[model samples]
Target: MHDLLFTVPGDEFPFTASVVVHVDGPRHVVRRTAGGDVHEVECTADDVDRVVDEALEALLAPIQVCRACGTPSASPDFTAVFERMHYICFHFEFEHGDADRDQACGLAGCPAG
Candidate 1:
């Protein structure tokens, strides 16, 4: 069990959570945070690598990126989740009004050229 804490961009409280991951043959038992968010996922042992990759992306700090026409932009907490035996990338953008959904490139300070 490891607690991953990410400093939120503000004077407010930071995002803190605990994640426990264990392998059980072709299944993984994941207990994230102490708020009772437990998940039992069915996946191949090979999927562990993918879980690690997703978890790393989720637990790490956020970096800037330019995914909209190669223009500098700020993004919210970057995270990836593996649920229902699938990997899904996510971000919490508090600003930037948009009526449509566009995927932002996972790069900080991508050149605008």
Candidate 2:
């Protein structure tokens, strides 16, 4: 069994929450705790990649503007990097800057926070 920690932006709140994904063979479980509330989902891991993708999409579904400049785009610039050491950096961008793209964007009032 393996586990990974991910930060997911809240939908109704302007804060980010930590999600723990537990993978055990063909079974995958996602858990989140916030504001004294705990949410979890258990499903058959038919496709691990697809499940992760869908979970990430649902986590950031409430974000409508760019994390950096608050620019609205139908298809915003989003990136996620997973390293061999189990480090994950996920964020959104509206414009390129001199900063590293593999780092998370800690923008206030943004989902990437």
How far is 24's C-alpha from truth in model 2 (Å)? Answer: 2.3
Model 1, 1-113: lDDT tens per residue? 33223332342433354445666555665444423444334446667567655553343333332322322233343222212111122222322224233543444422211
Clash pairs (backbone) in predicted model 2: none
Error of 1 at 29 (Å): 2.7
- Measured by lDDT, the strongest candidate is 2
Could you give me the TM-score of model 2 versus the true structure?
Answer: 0.41
Across residues 1-113, which tens digit of lDDT does each residue of candidate 2 receive? 99997665334444455567898888888876554666778877675566665666555545543444544334433433311111222223343234455543555433433
Each model's total of backbone clashes: 1, 0
For model 1, which pairs clash?
A: 64-108
lDDT of 1 at 46: 67
lDDT of 2: 0.53
Off by over 4 Å in 2: 8-15, 65-113
Best by TM-score: 2
